[model samples]
Target: MKDMTAFLPYASTANRPPLRPKLAPSGAGASAYATGPKAAKQTQTLRDNDDTELLTLFRNASFEQHFQPGSTVLLHGDPADAIYLVVSGTIRCCTVDSEGRRQIFAFPKKGDFVGVSDIDRWHFTAEAVDHVIVKSIPRLTLEQELAVNISLRLEMRTLMGGLLARRERQMLTLVSTKGPERLYRFLEEFAATRSGGGHIVLPMCRRDIGDHIGLSMESVCRAFSDLKRRGLIDLKSHEKYKLIGNAGRDATPLPLHADL
Candidate 1:
């Protein structure tokens, strides 16, 4: 659940601490620091622990809500007193350009976090893409709970690390990719986030996809048709897709670390 301006390069530095900290033990335990199965297992265990704690936080916050499709959940510059956890439906976050054209930032999915920025105000407006369910957590409560619980603190630190990694990947894609590549990569990466393999259902329409990826609706459609002709993806419908093998890039995208 990472929602922040981190995906967009910011001119002003954020207030949050470094996501990855140097935790190498000095001298004494250095021998055990070598890469091995135990170290890998420990890393996995840490992630598992953090997920459990995050679930607990969501439950304790107890501010569950449902929004009808197209409802505004938050506005740009709203008081940043809380963050959100989506249980279902997509949240489309956006902001207006200087010329008043709306620019969609992201389509955050189930289990995605919204407003995870450390700033005092929202950076973008968030709207329900469909019927949406979420848990809203006050920043004060989140901070107080983290302060008293060492395990929770550790979990938050780890989660933030993953979020930072994702933000980096997104920024890189946005800065570097061409239209067709961005569209293809976006679909590939978004599909990777689904726990169920293949047969991906895009939550956003073509216009939404174009807005997020900095492309035109025509470009997105053309890319899809191209990929379909190339047999890279099976288009059951405009929104439904089936990913075939041999995409001729890296392996299937790692989940959550997606943008273009």
Candidate 2:
């Protein structure tokens, strides 16, 4: 097995931006987003002057390009020549056991950074959960930028710290809770962090949420039912939710136990 302990310190230094406060539709505002395959194809031609400048400076640095869903972006032992950024779609970071059971580490949304392991190679594999577009930047170049740009370096350090903290909390929840509580906590957290108001636009499916939260798909569905019955949330649609009260207030009173 890969020695993840040694890399914990580095992982602790990433993902610190304030959560984007507004809940705008994907591709509805000034924020740049790469969606499906068609949008990814159009990104190259649609760039304005600023976009072109950034893209050109990093263009010579090439990484692997693939357009397939369920494809492995990086295997457990593959060299981390570069950090992979999701240009479009979702990428699931996960670890698999010798028995081939998989536990998802995180679901990196658009604009999230992946492959932050300090070592030369990744300790986990990143798989495309949908059709994806990824951009890879050389480690050397990243280091160079960090060395020269103090602000950028600090930003990266903060981002890494936040990401590590979030993952650590998720791991703790996975080991200590039942599927229902885990699913509830996951939705509560997602709603609070990403959704601006009562409306929540879910980026991933029930199966994806189940994998990440250490729950079966059926359990996740049942938790949603419980939440709705309690009048805590409403199912706006399959991929959307509307919070009735504060999203996570119900969870606040519960004590942490081995099985929640």
Candidate 3:
């Protein structure tokens, strides 16, 4: 592969693309965009440059597959011939022990890519949490592109790096955080990924939460109550929760193994 570093400026903090506003400005056109239409156009161009390239690759090379809730989208040890890019709904990736214990690795949602790390066979099983749609791109196609497309190569590296970092953080949290705090942290991160500001739906049930965070269903319920009592979260209903007051950011850090 050629040097991909030059094609991946958006991957770095210093050169990352500008954020697109939820709504365009309302003032005079010149003042609204900070420096007139020319600057605004430039900003838009920079933002869409790399994103358009990647989107084109997926759109041109992938085929869509839909899965119903509880359906297995990918099985552990299955041939890893394609990468699935989530289009809608959630996919829970997990592994089960010989004793039948399950540990969830991730709940990948829209815009997330799966099976990117697999070499020959899947290491985790992916199940649809609801009606799910994904675009599957064959590994051979991506590899051929990567051989000549520097931007795609760099983007792949960036994606893998992010996945590894997230897993590392999850492992550290599981070992060092209390159950209640763990639940709170998960809500915080989950809400951040979602679009609805402080309000978001819990796509998975309490049992799923327990499996993901290493808690029992009863313990998960208790942790929810604890968070509600602490004024960190407001449970609107069985599936909806609203974050309150910094969402426990002000709480003192719990000692490692405090739940023990």
Candidate 4:
């Protein structure tokens, strides 16, 4: 009805190489990219063509669907009849506690798949973060395709492994890091993979960001201020920002570029 992380598989960064700063090798931080370029390269290799092949199969069986901002894509505990392929816009996966506090787990963007983890019922609620389009492929169809196709099955396994790795990295970030560091790391990953030309357009609002990063909205604001103060980011507006340099605590010049 209202609120979800189902460990949704993200789009591969194979086409767009990571824009990492040449920071000296330090202890592994909680940031997802803290594994650095080598780890990212390994991940990219694992994900190669998985999205393309998965989409091709799912598209053959899926029907097109659309939603506006704040619309519920799927409810928690509903039968996991189908998984969704994001064609456009973003899906906010999160849950609400008894106190009505929300916690965001992931934002499933274009080329990402949602509801892949569940076999019978959905674990979290999926909400449209903005105007969205998705391809809804029935669970049975997906299972059948996976069963008959060895190559597809192996690819899906690799894809799921990558998703779990990222989920683990993010969990570590949430548990070990404070608000400002968590927010900065989130921005770094998004800028490296999703944004281009040092420009970032936040699809979700501050509240959503706080929910995702385990901070209050006020804290999220403070974190943004902190980034600005540290010269890590130039906030053109609340929803938009320009990346100035390295977001690391060392505060060196780091430029970000997105091939996509």
TM-scores for all predictions: 0.70, 0.64, 0.75, 0.73
- lDDT (Cα, tens digit) per residue for candidate 4, span 1-260: 33233333211111112212133132112112112221111112223354466766754566677765655677666678887888889888876654356667889988789987788977677776777788777788889888888877887787779878988988898998878778887887777767568568998888789989999889999989988877778999998887676546364323222211
lDDT of 4: 0.68
Error of 2 at 202 (Å): 3.5
For this target, which candidate reaches the highest TM-score against the unseen true structure?
Answer: 3
Output the number of the lDDT-best candidate.
Answer: 3
Off by over 4 Å in 1: 1-50, 247-260
Off by over 4 Å in 3: 1-53, 246-260
lDDT of each: 0.65, 0.60, 0.69, 0.68
Weakest ten-residue segment in model 3 by summed lDDT: 7-16
lDDT digits (tens) for residues 1-260 of candidate 3: 46432222111111112222222232112111111111111112223454644566676767677765655677666678888788989878877654345678799999888888987977777776766788877788878888899988788888889999999999998988778889988887788889665568988878778889999888999999888777678998867998775545445543223332
lDDT of 2 by residue, 9-119 (tens): 212111113212132233121112323223122234333464332243234443434434554566565667677666667777876555334567777755567765554
lDDT of predicted model 2: 0.60
Taking every candidate in turn, the Cα RMSD to the unseen true structure, in Å, is 15.9, 10.7, 15.8, 14.6
Better of 2 and 3 by lDDT: 3
Please report how far candidate 3 places residue 4 from its true position, in Å: 39
Off by over 4 Å in 4: 1-52, 246-260
